[model samples]
Target: MTNNQPAPDGVLRLINGYWATGVIGAASAHSLFTHLENGADTAAKLAARAEISERGTQTLLDGLVGVGLVQLHEGRYRNGPEASAYLVEGKPASLTSFAQLKLKHMGGLVALPDVVRAGGPVTDPTTEVADNPHWEEVVPAIAAQSVPAATLAAEVLGLAGAGPISILDVGGGSGIYSAVWLEANPQARATQLDWAPINAIARRLLVERGVADRFTSVDGDFHTTDFGTAQYDVALYSHIAHQEGPENNIAVLARLRQALRPGGALVICDYVVDDDRGGPAFPLIFAAEMLLKSKQGGTWRRCDYHDWLLKAGFEDVSFHSAPPATLVVAR
Candidate 1:
C-alpha cells in the first residue's frame, strides 16, 4: 500500500459506469427511496412494500449501499442523505422523474455505435419536441434539477435590480429561468417561446407558481418564430444552444439579439467546453451524448460563443462559472 503505483481505477470505472446508472435507474423506477423513507428497512419488508421478490430486493439494496445511495446499519437499510433529500417522492427537489428520463436515454445509447457509423443521429431529436408524452414529468423534473442554477443565474444577472424587465425565453423548456427571475423581481415579466406541448407544461408550472399573470407562452418552434424587434430587456437561451450547429446557433442568437432592446442583455446558459474542446469532463462527455442524440448539436467552446454573440451584435460579453454549466452574459 505504501508503494506508489499507477492505478487502473479510472478505466475500470469508465467500463462499469453503466452498472451504476442502471442501478440508480432501477431504484428510482421502483420508488425504492420512497419505500426506504417509509421505514422499509429490511429487505423482506422492502420487497413486500415494493411488490418484488425478497432475493431481488436484497440484491438491489446491497447495490444501493455499495453506491452510497442507501446506508446499512446492523441488519437495516436506510436512505442516504442524498437519497432522502432528492430521491424521495413528493420532495420539492425530487429527481425521480429525471432519473427515469435518464433511464430512457440509457436505453437509446445502445444505438451509439450505429450513430457513429452513420455519422449522425439514428433517431430524430426533434420528435421529442413535436410529440413528447413525457413532458408532464420531464418539465417539472428539469425545473427541479435547474432550481439551484436558476437561482444563481438570477443572482448573477442581477435580476433583482433589473427593474420592470421584459424578458424573452427562447426555447425555454420548463420556463424555470423566467419563473426564477420573476420571483426575484416582482415587476419582471417574461415571454416563453417553445413547442405547444412544452408551452402547456410551462403554463401549468407558471400557474402553479402563481406567476402566470406575469408570464406569457408563445407556442411555436423557436427556429421559425419571429421574435419581435427590440422590445425585451433580456433574452435567455438556457440549455438550448447545444442543440444546434454553429450556423444555426448564430442565426438563433441574432434573432434573440434582435428581440432584445437597446442595451439589453442576452444570457446563454449551457455546458460550454474549453477552447481546446477537451477536459471539463461534463461538456466533453456531454458532447458524446449529443452525438448519440442530436443530428447536429454538441457542446461549444467559450470562444465559439463569444464569436457568435459578437457576430450577433452583442457587446461586452462575459462568461460566468455556474454549477452543471457555464453562463455567458452579453449586452
Candidate 2:
C-alpha cells in the first residue's frame, strides 16, 4: 500500500529541520572529534575514550554518520574527510569557535518564528556591551582557526606586489595575520590592535607561532586610538568594520590612510552585499545576527568598500576572492 501523498511543506520542514543541531551538539558534548583526532575507532572504543555510554555513543555516531560527518565500517565509526580536517580538535582548521559562537547565540533561533512573520530580524543587536569579557578566550580560539582566510588574503596581497608592508589589524582578535605574515616574509611586520581582552589572546598566539619577536600588540579602543601617522604600509580592517554605519567606516579608512606610509595599502574584509542589495543570503543573514546581537549590523557591496577607501585618500582599490565577505584592498 503505497501512500501517494505529498507532505505539507511546513510538516516536512518541521521533521527535517534542526536535525543538524542534534548532530553537532552530540559531537561537541561528547568531544567525539577530539577523541578521533588520531584515527578511527569502534563505537565501544570511542565511547570509552570519550567517557560516554557505548549505546548512547553509538546512537550519536549513527546520527553523525547519517549526516555525512562520520563513516561506518562494520561496527567502527570514523570521521569523514571534511570533519576530520575542520572539526577535529588540535587541527589548525578546527571550528571550535564557530561551533561555540553558534551555541552561545543559539537563543537567537527562537526569533525565527517572528522573523518569518515579519520578513526580517526581530533582534536589536545595537546594544553594545561595556566590556567584552570573554574576548580573551574567544579571540585565541578564533584566530588559530582563521588561517584559511588569512592565507588567502595574504596571497592576494603578495600577488598585488605590495612592498615594504606594515599592517595594522584593527580588532585583529588573535593576531593570526601577524603570526602568519611575519613567518612568510621576514621583511614584513604587523601591529595587532584590539581591546585588552583580545590582546591577551593575540599575545599568546604570536608567541606560540614564534612571531612575538616581531609582532606588536596594541591595546586600546579602536574608536579612539590614534593609529599613528603614516607609519604603516598596510591597514587591515577585517571583521570589525562591518559593525558600524557607512560614516564610521569611511572615518576608519580615513584614519587608516593617515596612518599609512606613502603607497601603503589598505585591506577591508566584511560580508558584502551585492550592488543590487539582494541575495547571496549569508551576508544578509549575518546582518540579521548583528542586528540581534551587536549594536551596529554588518553590511555589504564591493562598491561600498571601494567608495569608502577612495574617500579615505586611497587609489586603485580592488577586491580579492574571499568568502561571503568582500576583501577590499587599496593603495
Candidate 3:
C-alpha cells in the first residue's frame, strides 16, 4: 500500500522563512539594489562597490535570485521589479529605512525562545534605550509607507467635503497622516502629539511638505497629555493600538473620545485580527513581534475593539477591510 501521510512542505517552508528574511535584510543593508542600479551588475563589480568579498557577494546574489528579489542573466545581476521599486535608494517608494528597522529587530526576535520561556520580553521596548536609535529612521520610513494608506483614509473619511475642521493625530510620527488630510482639505488644520524627538521629526516633515503653517506639534507622552476637551473634529489613532494592551487602549480611546466634538469621528487604523484570533497571517505574526518587543502589546480581535469602543462612548463603530490592515471608524 502507498503511504498516505502528507508531506510537511508548508511546515518546512515556515521553519526556513527566516532564510529569506536574512537574505533580503542583508541585501538591503548592503544597498545592493542601489549598487545594481548604479551599474554594478556583475558580482565582481558589486563586491568591489560594496567592499565585500567576491565569494560572499556571489552567494548573497544567488540567494537574492532564488528569492525573486534579483535576477541573474548572462552572469550579471539585476533587481526585480518589486526590488527596484521599493529597495533602491533614493526611489520614491524606497523602504531602506524600514529594512534597517527590521534588521534592528533581529536581536529581539532571535531571543524569542528565551522570552517565551520566561513568559515576557527579554528586552525593553521603551524609547529610553540609548542605543535604540532605530526610531529616528523608523518613524519617517513608516510615515512614507503610510502615505498611500493615509490618502485612502482621508478619502474614506470624506474629509474633502467635511469643511473646516480640527484634527488630533495621536502618536502621529512624522505627521504624515495629518499632512495628507490637510492637503486633501485646504480648510483643515491638525495638531500632532508625540514624544519630543518624534515631534521634531514631525515638524521637519510637515515643514518640508509646506503644510507646517496648518500643523501644530505637541511634544509629550500621549498617556499623560491633556488632549483638551471637545477640541478636535476628528481624532486619529493610526497603527497605535497594537503597541498597547487592552487596558491602556481602553483608557486612551476614552480620552480621545472626550477630546472629539459631540458628533465627531474617531479613526483607528491597525492590523486587527478576526474574533477567533486565528489566521490572517500578518496580524498573527505581528502579535509575535509585539510579544518579542513590547511589555504587554499584542494584536487584538475586532470584537475586542468593538467592545472597547462602545464602552468608550463611541457609536456606529464599523470596520473596513484594507489590505494588510483594517480601519475602524466610530462616531
Q: Pick the candidate with the highest TM-score.
A: 1
Q: How well is each residue in 58-145 modelled by candidate 1, as lDDT tens digits? A: 8888888988899999998999999998899887568887887776777777888899898788766665565878777667777777
Best by lDDT: 1
Q: Write the per-residue lDDT of candidate 3 for residues 177-284, one digit (tens) a residue.
A: 888899889899999988878888888888887888999988888989899999999999998899888999999999999999999999999999999888688988
User: Can you write out model 2's per-residue Cα lDDT over 220-303, one digit (the tens) per residue?
Assistant: 878889999989877888887777778888888899889988877777777787888785677877766655444444665777
Name every residue pair that clashes in candidate 1. none
Which rank order by lDDT, best down to worst?
1, 3, 2
TM-score of each model, paired residue for residue: 0.88, 0.85, 0.86
C-alpha lDDT of candidate 1 relative to the true structure: 0.86
In candidate 3, residue 42 scores what lDDT? 94
Q: lDDT for each of the candidates?
A: 0.86, 0.74, 0.85
Off by over 4 Å in 2: 1-18, 73-75, 111-130, 159-164
Candidate 3 has an lDDT of 0.85
Query: Which of 2 and 3 is the better model by lDDT?
Result: 3
How high is the lDDT of residue 39 in model 2? Answer: 58
- Residue pairs of candidate 3 with colliding backbone atoms: none
